[model samples]
Every structure is written in structure tokens, then in C-alpha cells.
Target: MKKAVFLDRDGVINEVLSSRVKFVNKPSQFYLLEGVGEAISLLNLAHIPTFIVTNQGGVGLGFMKESALHNVHKKMIAELAKYGAHIEDIAYCPHKPTAGCVCRKPEAQMLIDLASAHNIDLSGSIMVGDREPDIEAGKKAGCKTVLIGDESDNFAQANIVFPHLLAAVPWILEELH
Candidate 1:
């Protein structure tokens, strides 16, 4: 089976939106965090399939429509293309926390679904992201978890934590080999 890398959107991929970048409802709002494109390209060059696991509750919460999210993703893909990186698959949970959807991060269902659908060997895969939930999902899915930020000095779910996605590359490459 093949291994994959799952990435989170929002603060992990781009700066967390605020009044200035307020929700990424359009292509213009889609910006890449420093080293994101290069990091993704590095994973691509290493022959790792990359996937995006995002919690787009904005749609369910009425912050934006689904079409807007699609547009932003399309733009995001085009931008990544310029750097020779591409996401193999994308999955999102549009439900809010109150809705308790299965696909939400920290639940592991998204990873499980993707693993099954993509024929991934969960044990060999790594889930890299910035939030606790992202790491938790990886743990629950039985993959190696790498937290892409030292925001919280104490993250119990992740086996490892680094300052950014770029820092996690060599480990991911090693894990695949």
C-alpha cells in the first residue's frame, strides 16, 4: 500500500483569516504560507501522495457558500501548480462542531475514508498540520502525526511537533523509505 501526507488548511496552509484576510471565500483570499509550496513540492518529489483534510465549517455555518470554497480551492490548486506541487485528493467536513459530522478532524473518519479509498497504508502515512485536532485525527487513524507549529508547548496527541511544514519533510521522507 502507498503512504500519503494529509494537510490542514486555514492557519496551517495560509495565515489564519482575520479582518484583513477575512474568510477565504474568493481566489484572492487564497494565499500560501511561507514555505508551503516548497514543502509540498518536496513531498511530491519524494513520491508521496499528498491530500488535504480541511474543516470547512464556514459553509455549514453560513459564513460562505460551497461554491466559494470550490473557487478558492481551484485557485489554490492553480497556485500550487506554479510550484510543481499538487494535492492528490481533497476532503472536507462542512458540518459544525454541534453537527458532529464523521469527517471532522480529531474524529479520524476522514483519514479512514481516504485510507480505504486510496489504498493507503495508514501506518506508513503521516498527517501534518498546525492544530491539535489535525494531530489527533492522525493518531486516531493510526498514522504518524506531525504537528506543524510549537504554538502549544504541550501537545499530547502528536508523536512529534516542529515549527513548520518545512521542518517535517526529512522525517516524512525517511518514514516513506
Candidate 2:
């Protein structure tokens, strides 16, 4: 079975505006966090497939249109490609947090679906994110979890916690070895 890495989009892949408590709703607002491209490039060189699994509640809340989100993702992918990094696929739940959707983070539906479609070995896989929901989903899906951020509260659930995505890559590489 193939090994894969699942990443949360907002804080994990891009800079998060803490004051707003929301996602980058426009391409103009989207900015790749430092070292993220290089980190993803390292994973690509190691032949590990990476996928983005995110909860896009902004859509359901009418904060932004789905087309706007797609535009942001397009720009993100294009930017990553410039660094020779690639994302295998992106799975997002466009439902409100209160919608009780099966595909949101903290629920393993999206990861399970991706694993089934891609023939992934969850035991050997990893999920990296900056929130507890990300870790929760990873655990539910039987994948190791890496929490990226300095939040004290979010640290308890992750198998490994790092300051950022780049900092977490070495540990993942070591585990693969």
C-alpha cells in the first residue's frame, strides 16, 4: 500500500489571520507561509503523495463563493509548482460547522475516502495541521498526526508537534526511513 500525507489548508499551508478567525477567502489574501514550498518539495522528492483535506466553512456561511475558493486553490497550486512541489488532490467540506457533515475535519470521512481511492496505508500515513480537528481526523483514520503551530492547547492530541510544516518534515522523513 502507498503512504500519503494529509495536510490542512488554512494554517498549515498558508498564513492565517488570527484576528479574523477565518480562512483566506481570496487569492489576494492567500500567502504561502515561509518554508512551506520547500518542505512540500522535500516530500515530493521523497515520493510521498500529499493531499489537502480542509473544512471550507466559509462557503457554507456565505463568506465567499465556491468559485472564489477554487481561484485561491488554483493560485496556491501554481505557486507551489514554481517550487517543484505538487499536491496530489484537495478534498474540502463546504459545509457549516454546525451542519454535522461527515466530511469535515474531526471526522475521518474525507481521509477515508481519499485512502480508499488512492490505496493508502493509513498506518504509515501522516496528517499535518495546525488544529485539533486535524489531529482528531488523523487519529480517527488511523494515521499518525503532526500538529503545526505553537499553540499549547493543540499540542496534546498530536503524535508529534512542530512549529511549522517545514519543521515537521524531518520527523516524517525519519519515520519513513
Candidate 3:
């Protein structure tokens, strides 16, 4: 079994827009948050497989086309590549929150599927996210959870918490060793 890191996309990887326009609808709307490149690059250098598990309900709501999301990912990938970072795979839930899809956060389906596909050891993996649902999913999947933002409500649930992804990197690397 292999260990891995799972990251939530929105607030963890890039800036989350205001409530009115919450999704990155186009490539231009996507921007890697500060330290994201260096953080991911370090993970790459360590040979840790990293993946993105996100909820993109905007697709189901028709806020943006799937193609647009692809473009946004392309932009993100290019940006990360500039720092020698790479992502192993990406899994997302396109269903609306009201749809209650199994792939959505708070459900372990996406993590389970990825773990199965990648032969990962869930107990040895880490799931990093900015919200409570992300922590819930990690718990369901039996992985250690790291919260990237100050969500007081989630502090008890997360195995660890940090102000940002870059700040969490050292601890994450320590855990792997």
C-alpha cells in the first residue's frame, strides 16, 4: 500500500470567491493561492502522490460548462508545473448539493474510489481541505484529516489545522516519515 495526499480544490488550492460567484467558471478565474506552487512542488519532490478531490456543484447547476472547468484545471496544472509540481489524478462531484450524491463531500465515495484505483493505504493517507465536509469525508475514509483554514467548528474533527496549505506542508511531510 502507498500513502498519498488528497486536497480540496476551492479554498485550499485557490481563492474561494464570494458567495455570489463561488465557482471558478473559467480559466481566467482560477489563480493558485500563495505558496500553493511551492507546497505542491515539495510534495512532488518527496514523491508523494497528490490528488484533488473537490465538489464542483456549479456544473450541475449550469453555472459553467464542464469544458470550462477543464480549462481552469489546465491553467492550474500549468501554473503548478512552473514550480515542478504535479497531480496524480482528480476526482470531483458535479452533483448539486441538494442532489445528495454519493460522490459529494461528507461522503467517502470519491476518496474510496481513488484509493482503490491508486492502491493507496487510506490509513496512511492525509486529506487536506478548508471545510468541515472535507474533514467528514476523510474520517469516513479512515484517513487523517487536516483543515487548512480557521473553522472553529471543525477543529475537533480535524487531526490537525493550519492557516494555509503551505503552513501545513512541514507537518504533513513529518507525518509521512
Q: TM-score of every model?
A: 0.93, 0.95, 0.95
For every candidate, C-alpha RMSD to the true structure in Å: 1.6, 1.7, 1.7
Order of all candidates by TM-score, from best down to worst?
A: 3, 2, 1
When 1 and 3 are scored with lDDT, the better candidate is: 3
What is each predicted model's overall lDDT from 0 to 1?
A: 0.84, 0.90, 0.90
* Per-residue lDDT over 1-177 for candidate 1, one digit per residue giving the tens place of the 0 to 100 score: 998998888876776755568667667888887788898999999889999999888888888888988988898888788889899888889887678878888889988888889999999899887888888888888888888778474375687888878878888888878
Candidate 3, residues 1-177, lDDT tens digits: the string is 999999999999988775434568888778788899999999988888999999999899999888888888899999999998999999999888899889999899999999999999999999999988999999999999999877575753799989989999999999986
Candidate 2 structure quality by residue, lDDT tens digits, 30-120:
8888899999999999999899999999999999999999999999999899899999999999999899989998999999999999999
Query: How many backbone clashes does every candidate have?
Result: 0, 0, 0
> What's the residue-level lDDT of 113 in candidate 1?
88
Error of 2 at 107 (Å): 0.3
